[model samples]
Target: MSENEHMLAVRSRINDLAAKAKTPEGLTEAEKAERADLRQEFLANFREGMRSQIEMLQVIDKDGKEVTPEKVKQIQRDKGLRDD
Candidate 1:
């Protein structure tokens, strides 16, 4: 599935779990398991998306210099996303 579709599915499951949490009955064991799995998948997707976006970033200074943070620069360098 596409990223948008995957994200929608994850969000839907999360919302479902949230609603279950508000009820006096609460989530069943199966629902709790599903929630944990969905949460992990969602976090993995979020981290990957953030990493991709950050990889393409180039921070500029007021003086028109490349002032990207050292941490990000190190990631880029390690990933071979940038030579500098």
Candidate 2:
């Protein structure tokens, strides 16, 4: 499946596991392990998306000075998304 489909599946599984955990029966060790792995996968995807947005960012003040943060600027520069 595609990335979106995969993410949706992961999210659905995470929710299901969470609901199970709240019940009196709770989760088995394997289910708990699966939930942890799925959570990590979800977070990794989220961080990459945030990083992509940050890399594409451009900030300009009223004086027309580019005010993007140095760390983000360096990321953009390294990715060849910006010059200087």
Candidate 3:
């Protein structure tokens, strides 16, 4: 599945688990493990999406100087994330 699809699935599962835990008794061990795994997947997807947005960003000073961070530049260069 695409990242978006996977993320949606993860979110749905996490929500389901949360609703289940509102009952008299909480989730079973296996359900708890699944919830944890889904939460991890959701976080991983969130971080990757945030990283992509940051990578696509360019910081310019009042002098029109490109001030993007050195590490970000290197990451872009290494990964060919940008065209310029």
Candidate 4:
């Protein structure tokens, strides 16, 4: 598989693990810890992806406006947007 495909597979697996963790018959303590760590890793990856997209948008917009996370959140709130 390509690198992108591998990354997608890993992300899918992480999502599956997260869903499992959320169940009432959830993971054991060690499994839960592992899931939490994986979730954090996924979150970091997701945040980085969002930052990159925001940077691209800032370049495209190029209106001398700062694009911080707060700004993004405010825009989302104003526009009634939610992350899928």
**Judged by lDDT against the true structure, how good is candidate 3?**
0.88
Question: Which pairs in model 4 have colliding backbones?
Answer: none
Tens-digit lDDT track of model 2 for 1-84: 999999999999999999999999999999999999999999999999998887899999999998998998998888888767
**Model 2, residue 74: displacement in angstroms?**
2.3
Worst 10 residues of 1 by lDDT: 75-84
Candidate 4 lDDT, 25-83, residue by residue in tens: 87778876777776777678788888757643422237876544666666655656634
Model 1's lDDT to the true fold? 0.91
lDDT of each: 0.91, 0.95, 0.88, 0.68
Residue-level lDDT for 50 in candidate 2 = 92
lDDT of 2 at 12: 100
TM-score of 3: 0.81
Q: Write model 3 residue lDDT over 6-81, tens digit each, in one string.
A: 7788898899899999988889999999999888888888899899988878899999999999888888988887
Best by TM-score: 2
Q: Please list the Cα RMSD from the true structure of every candidate, rounded to 1 decimal place.
A: 1.9, 1.3, 2.0, 10.7
N/CA/C clash count, model 4: 0
Ranking by lDDT: 2, 1, 3, 4
Which should have the higher lDDT, number 1 or number 3? Answer: 1
User: Which regions of candidate 3 deviate over 4 angstroms?
Assistant: 81-84
